[model samples]
Target: MEDETMSNTSEKIAENVLLLAVARLSMALSLPALGFVAYLLNLNLEQKFQAQENKIVAQKESSDRQANLTTARVETVERVAQSAIDQAGKVNERLISVETKQTQESAASERFQAATLTRLDRLQDSIVGQSNAISALTATLQADQDRNRPPPP
Candidate 1:
């Protein structure tokens, strides 16, 4: 009876040890699989982070380019407006110059017309004086001829 009881107690101890060993083996074997899954998750997370960073960089570059383009366009518009203003001023100056010239020509023409009219009046007076002198000479010649007649009836 003492030998059977000792044998039964040893058998129960062996069974408990076997069960504990099997549980430990399963836990150990699952470590690599869990580690592999964790590694894949970490790799995916790193790739996503890099992709987000790349997107942010691209957006910054695009915004910078757009700002530069807007600046260039504004500058161009300003230059064109300045040029137009300059051209308009030049045209106005030319128009003023033309108007001044026209006024000067009109005055000069008026003066020339006045001078011509004065000259014509003087010419008419001279011609009248010459005709009077011719008439006086003819009358003197006719009187002398009468005074020198032979008195023959």
Candidate 2:
């Protein structure tokens, strides 16, 4: 019985010593392992930040392109509007010129018509005066012939 008790006590001590050695080894390795883990986490964060930066850069480029396109479109629209305004102005000028020319022609035609009417009125008055003079001459000639002839038998 004494031998068995000593043997059991020795075994318990050996087991405790082995557990303590394992715990010490884990504590010794934990610092480097934690540093490695922290390094890996930092690398992952850097990669994520780089990806965000790349996305921002791509978005900026796209925005610049869109702005340039909009500017070009605005310029084109302005040019077209200017062209239309110029054409309208030219058309207005031509219309005014045509109106002025028409007015001049109408005035001349009215003047010609008035002159023709006056000439016709004068011609009619001259013809009426000549007809009266012929009638008076014929009456005087008949009276003279009656005086020259003898009375009726």
Candidate 3:
């Protein structure tokens, strides 16, 4: 009877030790799982941060490009406006020059016409005087002929 009691007590002690070992093993496995979960969370956070950074960089680049395009368009418009203004100035100058030349030419032509008319009037007067002289000379010659003619026989 004593030997059977001793064997039963030893069996109970072995079961208690097994229970303790199981609890210790479960705790070890839980630690590794928790660490793995924490690593995954850190990785997800890093990915989100990196994506946001990339978006910000892209936005900056887009803004810079837009600014450059606007500046270029403005410069082109300014150049065109300046060119138009320069062309207008040149046209104005040309018009003034043309008007001056036309006025000068008109004035010179009037003087020339006046001189020509004066010369024509002088020529007409000289022609009239010469015709009168020729008529006088012809009359003298006829008188001499009459005197010199012999009487009709």
Candidate 4:
């Protein structure tokens, strides 16, 4: 009975020691495993942040390009409108000049016509006076020739 008791006591001690060693080993390994998991999560979060930043940068560049194009388009339209206005003003000026010249020419033509009519009236009066003088001369010559003639039987 004494031998059996001693053997049972030794066996219980060995089993307890084995269980304590397994617990210690697992604790040591779990600490490193947890640290490794944390490191992996940090790396994944950094990669996600970098990708978001790149996407934001690309969007900003595209917006800037669109703004530049819109500005250029607006400027071009303004220049075209200004040029059209300038051309219209020049055309109006030329039209006014032509009208003024036409009015002056019309006035000159009227003055010339009036002067020509006055000259024609004076010429007609002179020709009528010359015709009356010629008639008087012919009657006097006939009277003289009749006085100079000899009587005939």
Better of 3 and 4 by lDDT: 3
Displacement of residue 122 (Cα, Å) in model 4 is: 99
Candidate 2 lDDT over 1-153, as tens digits, reads 989967976775576567556655655565566556556655765676576556555655665665565556555555776775665555556555655655565566567557655755665565456555645554565466446544544
Which sections of candidate 3 miss by over 4 Å? 1-8, 82-153
Per-residue lDDT of 80 in model 1: 80
lDDT of 4 by residue, 1-153 (tens): 989967866775566566445645655565465556555655765676576556555655655565565556555555776775665555556555655655565565557556645654565565456544544554465465456433442
Residues 1-153, candidate 1, lDDT per residue (tens digit)? 989967976775576567556645655555465456556655765676576557556655665665565556555555786775665555556555655655565566567557655765665566456555644654565466556543543
Error of 3 at 50 (Å): 1.7
State the lDDT of candidate 3 residue by residue for 61-80, as single tens digits.
66556556555655555577
Task: State every prediction's TM-score relative to the real structure.
Answer: 0.45, 0.44, 0.43, 0.45
Candidate 3: worst-modelled 10 consecutive residues by lDDT: 144-153
Error of 3 at 28 (Å): 3.0
User: Candidate 4: where are CA atoms >4 Å away?
Assistant: 1-3, 82-153
Q: lDDT rank, highest first?
A: 2, 1, 3, 4
Off by over 4 Å in 2: 82-153
| lDDT for position 146 in model 1 | 52
Q: What value of lDDT does candidate 2 attain over all alpha carbons? A: 0.59
Give the clashing pairs for model 1. none
